[model samples]
Target: MLHSRETYQPSPSFTQPEMITIILLYLLIALLASVVGSMAGLGGGIIIKPLLDFFNDYDLPTIGVLSAATVLAMATVSLIKLRISKVAIDRKNGFIIAFGSILGGFIGKWIFNFFVLEIGLEQLIGKIQASVLAILLLIIFIYIKFQKNMVTYQMKNKLGILLAGVLLGLIAAFLGIGGGPLNMALLIFFFSMDAKQASINSIYIIFFSQLSSLILVGTTTGFGSYDLSIIWYMILGGSIGGLIGSIFVQKLTSRRIERIFNIVIVIMILINIYNVVKG
Candidate 1:
């Protein structure tokens, strides 16, 4: 159901060298996204989607598929590396949120297929996604800016965490992201978790969320709907980047990563705005 490379057909416009170069570019981007996403407790989609949009002419569904593949690779490799390095994954709470995220992914993908794909509402959906994401990212930035560390203020609210995961999963699937910004925000600001730990847990949450998304998209979009071969390039980069990022995560501080994360979000919002207006 996933990684169906059989459907890939490189376009006639590119020669062999050109195709290899483009694939290399995709790999590089995925690698960078995974590295940053891992350090910041995100699943790396926010970075991947816009860069993919800026560099290529692929449609949203194709982007969604590629984005899912990238996130899956990042999550898998990062989780493995972290586990081997003895990083705590917070299996208790992380799994609670992940389960909810899985359910939400199906719901999100159903909406995407039926409303956006089937009805051909790409423009409308894109606009809505851009607008909502811009607003949310801004809110997250402001919220984090003012909050002092209440690191020990424990939130054992299972229901709340689950609901948050559902929301994150739905948004991730709909927007073709790994819910990095949102997930990191949830862990760092609301739950009072440390940045490094939150980042690790964020990948865990994203792993299951993206898995559900790929399965759901495969069912709805069918095989060969997009160039499946491109996913291999992205996955390779994401895997390597994931392992690299996990190894370096302990050396960095959350505050520094948070600042960089917000900057990236602002830039992404600007890109989204430009796309919306240019449309």
Candidate 2:
């Protein structure tokens, strides 16, 4: 199924006007996703998958590749700006996790291939992944909306954090997200980082994981035929949005953004649930 040679050439049904509208709409959505996703420390990748699955005609593999690329664009802008601003980053640990993600991402691609080709569950896999992500995001959202005190753990579990990267990478490939939300949660809960620092770390975590996933996706998926224009739209939107979101987060404090983040997560959860049922 993944290796199907019957490609998507432009059809009369898939008209130029419709394509232009799609491009503009997706561009705006990606921009918003990156903006809020940056401030919220979720790296914008989480928002791309379910939304694209809902709206676009792209397949799961293409969706995954595009999601990773968009996240990469956003993360690149954010990280570069962070460097210019001289904000401190936990480089050593972040790189360690990224190193593990390299292998984990490849393994995840293999799993994705099996699911898509062997089991013929390409669309089903996306739906299942979206459903699980929605549930997890819902739990986090509920905790955020209701909990009075956010717990912060001591940063004593370096080895555990490093080991956790494997799962993060797997999820990065599986869900087409950079694992920003999960990384932020882990940092705050176990690494004793505040939401601000957690957001910073989450950006790097996303960078590494998404990079790995993108590399594996190209090789494994064999991007022979498909409209590549969708990718450029995502890149343009994600890049600009990432810069804006990074600046926004940096200018304002993360404490305020947390509430908005919770709300956004709830919205995404509802959207995912809808997609799951509809799919």
Candidate 3:
């Protein structure tokens, strides 16, 4: 079921100054998340979504929108920085994956709307998302921990690559995550990409998938009742974080980046698990 647009009114208890402070706090969180996300090629949304969910400041839909916007901003800036620094991406495979992600983005959003609006299961959806995310992160963490013993491939089949993108985008869009960890793991396993290469390509895939998802949201529900006041702050934080993270990626070795990725994944897993219980 489709719903009409509604404006979100701030709580009457929060004064103008208080609201500003709250927005600033969110900005700080976004900044920190973006830095870690960009450096590890996790696209920041994985961190942002669970943390925002923890605060319980906004509804699930609003949180999803905010996370998507911030991730898109971070990805844009990060890609630009990489380009300027002569970091080459696998454009053929990247674009193929991105095209598939766009299709997946559309389907994922439709499913989300169906559950949230049609079934009226917003809270349940949040819990489900958190639980699934936690489980997936745990699996990825385990895989990363013993990756040396696993058989990796150099997948060159375009159709397989496209299907992989679809699956990645579907999960990411549905969970309101930027699909960073999954992208990293899949890129490494299927394409035999090193950590640095996977990170760069992960951001590349995130940019297109997230952009498509946001476009679908805007075109269909027109932002619904999500808070817009903190959006500018999110953009500012994302841009700054993207710049800093890109520079760090350039300076750091692949081993160092993997260490950062592992640390962040563990932290995210804990946070998401808490969200599941709290929700």
Output the number of the TM-score-best candidate: 3
The per-residue C-alpha lDDT of model 3 at residue 246 equals 91
Q: Model 3: how far is 22 from its true place, Å? A: 1.6
Model 1, residue 117: distance off in Å is: 1.7
Q: What ranges in model 2 sit over 4 Å off?
A: 1-13, 143-151
Question: What's the true lDDT of residue 212 in model 2?
Answer: 77
User: Cα miss at 219, model 3 (Å)?
Assistant: 0.8
Which segments of model 3 are wrong by more than 4 Å? Answer: 6-13
In the range 46-144, model 1's lDDT, one tens digit per residue, is 888877766654666778888888889888988888888887778988898898888888888778766665566776877776777777777876766
User: Which digits, one per residue and each the tens of the lDDT, describe model 2 over residues 171-271?
Assistant: 66767777877777666666666667778778887887888777765665555554556788999999998899888878767677776677778788888
Runs with alpha carbons beyond 4 Å of true place in candidate 1: 1-18, 149-153
Model 1, residue 120: what's the lDDT? 64
Question: Pairs clashing in candidate 1?
Answer: 41-199, 42-180
Rate residue 133 of model 2 by lDDT: 89
User: Residue 30 in candidate 3 has what lDDT?
Assistant: 85
Q: Write the per-residue lDDT of candidate 3 for residues 207-237, one digit (tens) a residue.
A: 9999998898888877645666788899899
